[model samples]
Target: MGRQVLTWIGAQAAASGRRYVRLATARDDRPLRAYYERAGYRHVGDPPHAKWPTSLYERAIESG
Candidate 1:
């Protein structure tokens, strides 16, 4: 059910011509990062002056 919802959201993003889905997670959050990785997100970098050690990630919206 979770995967289905994510897939649907990805489809919507793609249909809207968005090239990437961006998100942020705490750098120390290994489990959360793993979850995003499992969903195909790649860690890009960290945001500037973040209050906590937050990491940025993005997933490409493959054009159909």
Candidate 2:
């Protein structure tokens, strides 16, 4: 189901002329991080705000 959602999202982004998809998840959630990584998202970096710790990830949207 996750993969399906990602596929849909990628399609929508491509239709909108976007090149990448970006998301943020809790920094300490190892399992969730691994899941995103397995989905082809690469860890970009953390946001500069100190109020909350989050890990940023980005995946390139392939052109069809």
Q: Write the per-residue lDDT of candidate 1 for residues 1-64, one digit (tens) a residue.
A: 8678778878989989999988899999999899889999999998789999999998999886
Instruction: Return the top candidate by lDDT.
Output: 2
Give the poorly placed runs of model 1, Cα more than 4 Å off.
Answer: none
Can you list the residue pairs that collide in candidate 2? none
Please list the C-alpha lDDT of all candidates, in the order they appear: 0.90, 0.93
Model 2 lDDT, residue 57, Cα: 95
- TM-scores for all candidates: the values are 0.82, 0.91
Cα lDDT of model 2 by residue, 1-64, tens digit: 9989988998999999999999899998999999999999999998888478899999999987
lDDT of 1: 0.90
Name the best candidate (by TM-score): 2
Report the error of model 2 at residue 2, Å.
Answer: 1.2
